[model samples]
Target: MKHLFSVLCISAGSILSLSAQQTQKPILYGRNWMAITGKPLAATAGAMTFQKGGNAVDAACAMLAATCTMWDTLSWGGETQALIYNPKTKKVIAINAMGVAPTGATIEFFKSKGYNFPPEYGPLAATTPGTPGGLIYMLVNYGKLSLKQVLEPAMKMAAGYPIEAQAANSIEKGKEHINQWPYSKKVFLTHPGEKREAPEAGEIFVQKDLLATLTKMVEAESKALKQGKTRKEALMAAYDRFYKGDIAKEFVRGAQEQGGLITMKDLANWKPLQEEPLQVNYKGIDVFKLQQWTQGPVMLQALNILENFDLKGMGYNSPKYIHTLYQAMNLSFADRDFYYGDPTTMPKGPIQGLLSKDYAKERAKLIQYDKNNTNIGPGNPYPFEGKTNPYLNLLQQRGYEMDTTKRNFAPKHDLGKINTSSDDVYQERLLLGTTSIEAADKEGWVVSVTPSGGWLPACIAGETGIGMSQRMQSFVLDSALNPFNVLAPGKRPRVTLSPSMALKDGKPFLASAVQGGDTQDQNLLQFFLNVTEFGMNVQQATEAANINTNQLWLSLGGTKTEDRMPKPGQILLNNNTPSATREALQEMGYILSFGARTSGPINAIYFDWKHGSLWGGSSNHGEDYGIGW
Candidate 1:
């Protein structure tokens, strides 16, 4: 019997190669340390603070204080932005711990109260929270721990834990604004007798006034390390008991009982700055980000106009590599909406001619490749800095038209069936709310933060459970073509919390992040071109299938007809892509829609360096995790 049909065809080809390696989604190995967050108990409290030795900035500020007590759509009176790196000062930095505006938040005090925009939630969209002075300034400069031991796992999970189901559906969609604020309905609802709801997801969700305001800043850094002081003067006496004592007079009495404009000298002239990180390079890696008040140089000007094309011979997520990455993310978000802002009030030829490379080779000769174009704009990076396009006479005195047959639009706010852990209707339509974290170790160190504004136009400041940041609803009240994101008074607002890192030939190599809001660097530039041009691995480059560019321009803050363009042949994609690349991007004219999980989960790691190993991943789309051995 011819050797019994070659042993049953080699045992049916080893059971179809072990069922295609058990349907492919593994990639999470580790050797020394790793962490990917957006919950799973804050990536097991950053792999138990790197197995108790703590490094990658004290396991990313102990997984950002255990994701501010297991995520309530990212808070602890939100705002964090990181990058870190520092393999013994081979340097990287850029923390910024974003949060400013409120020297009495101007713009003529919300246009003399007529308020065209910038009051998304309350206390005049509060600021000055700065995630506990940017997590105690990364635990008193590159942590070793102690801010009472990296906030003892967020004060033991805010004294309780258990609340999940997407943070009990964002406290049941901010339960009517936490029943109109009685200290945000006694710390985010769950009464019992007066029958309040939301706290079900396996119950137990306590807050005990955010563990008594993180136990009064860990007993003001353990009474200044028992009067002996010195762990940087006991973390500056717990950062002057949260910005100049008594939690800055309870954030100026919850911004003067809600008609807010923060003070106590805007929480004693807030801090968290530290700079140096807007890098670029690409292919050979480098990357970094945060500066130009973030929209992070629209992924290094869309990876310098997709490095003059040929994206791995146009394949991965092909449709001519997602229409040349939607024409280099609509020409790097039309130069990030006419030159990004707040580099000290914009305009010095917008970030040296929108991060030149001969202005990205003249914006990569206006990307074409078989058309799907949308009459993109914002270029003339100030004629490569020799000046002029100073917002071209305010985009022709604000006419800034487009039309392109009304770009075939939608999303004027549907938030595509919510729950990517609450951006409460995109922060009550002021847009961009986020969450992210990434870490690495084995001493080569790495980081990638991204916490975000307090949840959906949140407020809570008084009793100190602390949930302020409506990141001043991302500024802009259009003081003439939005100066560089207008509305000042202690400036800073022009955020969309971007957090990425990379390096490769020089070390680190990838540390990604995400949480939409103008699709955070278009989902970290399609997960860094799906791991540098389709090699795919941080879990198949964040589980592949992406695409976003609803024709750029919308970094949130409104007026100019609630700006955020995207219509000229719309393009969301993502419903598990590939139906022949969605009919080749609808035969290259674009228009598609598909929705749900619109490319914003990510949370990466990578490293590898010839098998030194790390490799992590996340993106199951939402309650992401991805820990490591």
Candidate 2:
């Protein structure tokens, strides 16, 4: 452990060194392909698939499966959103596998229960599980591997594996909550009723129920294949068993038996969708993200606004650059809070207008070069789309109006001023995370996925070791808060899990993703700029100093008026930031806090089209890793 830490310091220094040096975890270089994710073993799962002659999609599915089993801040019941670059069609396609509010999830129901929003924990917080079906969907449609084959590494680990300190400590931290659910107690607690109930670091943690669950799915696939079903058909059979067969029965029975809203029909009704992703041209690169149902558009929106400026000329992380970036993000998130939501349902926001370059230009004009704009609200995009804004009155009721007269949301000197303890809870929710998967092969297939939900202290359904997603907390109960995003039965919440991909000269350029809720896009936006504007290599960009804004409404956790409220003018800066830059930001009406590692721990694959090689980057912030061959 001591040696690893020493090497890590060197790795971190290697990236920051002006002179050419080796990174702590060096950039992955491969002529054929590369795979990267949140855990070393999980990346190896993708590598195993690649070695088995799998395409990027197949390798990605394998990586997601491994991460879920290993609890890389997510699990099987979580949601998955992916952007795949199909070399054949030369088009980017989106996979939206986010689960919806289950039956009895109406706002009135929650309000009657004396809740501000959905409960933050337990069965009540769950949506239907989506990852299982999502994994099957991606494999059947875009992959050339069988469900049984893809799940091999995950199944092996599910049986038993030496648990890492991070996951073990998470179980320890969340043990109080885990104790609430009997099944979770059985799976996560290796020494229940002891001083430290959760497994110790490096303990061989085992989950027989989860292993059985995985075996059942593989069994279903095997049976279907033996009965003369095709590979895709067999995969669907496994999906059916999970959502409609015995597994579904047990999951529903277990959840409802414990207080969840999911019904068997809800499970059966939910299915993954394939759609066109949202895209914006930054200079000449075409960047793509999941559509309006997610916070993804926020990144594209910010990019459009930044496109109007000569970002390169401002210099990197300069006072002027940071100020412009912060303001643009606030502007984008203002629209996200008011307008972005489940576009598949009634009263969709002006998505067409929101993404319009002209609309972005109009919004960009609102930025003040000298100071931060704490009072910025959603801009009018109706004119650009040629449609009258239907809910103009609704827009006025934004629940996050700045109250400078009240305590400062982010006081400089006394950073621990308002909402002290509650601030930590709010930050956790705002940054409730997900694990990312990035895979690419020489065959031109590339996959970027951000899979989340069902982290530790997660409620496990009976008999099945699967964790239920707490994604229901992302919903808004009041239409006035966000008409398009207000909680309703069968409606998907606007999610924070976003994966990114970019194409240059009509070919894949970069595939990147990270696991910080609101900060996902913030970090990604800067990473893109680090490469495009500052000319940092992919590895440097992944480890680059970046800032985060708490100016957006919280997407996860909390249940009161103040809980989801915005923290205007509050920004998190890296501790290593120049004191001058910090002072410059504070003068611009910004309250600054600091962290050693600020980026998303972003993992990415940059297509070195020039050299005909693939360059991989896994950030130094966390345990994220990458492998290439």
Which one wins on lDDT? 2
For candidate 2, lDDT tens digit of each residue in 303-325?
Answer: 99999987776667766778889
Residue 397, model 2: lDDT of: 49
lDDT of 1 by residue, 275-300 (tens): 88888897678898988787888889
Least accurate 10 contiguous residues by lDDT in model 1: 11-20
Give lDDT: candidate 1, residue 204: 78
Which number leads on TM-score? Answer: 2
For candidate 2, the lDDT comes to 0.86
Which residues of candidate 2, in runs, are more than 4 Å off? 1-22, 399-423
Span of 10 residues, lowest total lDDT, candidate 2 = 411-420
Clashing pairs in 2: 11-24
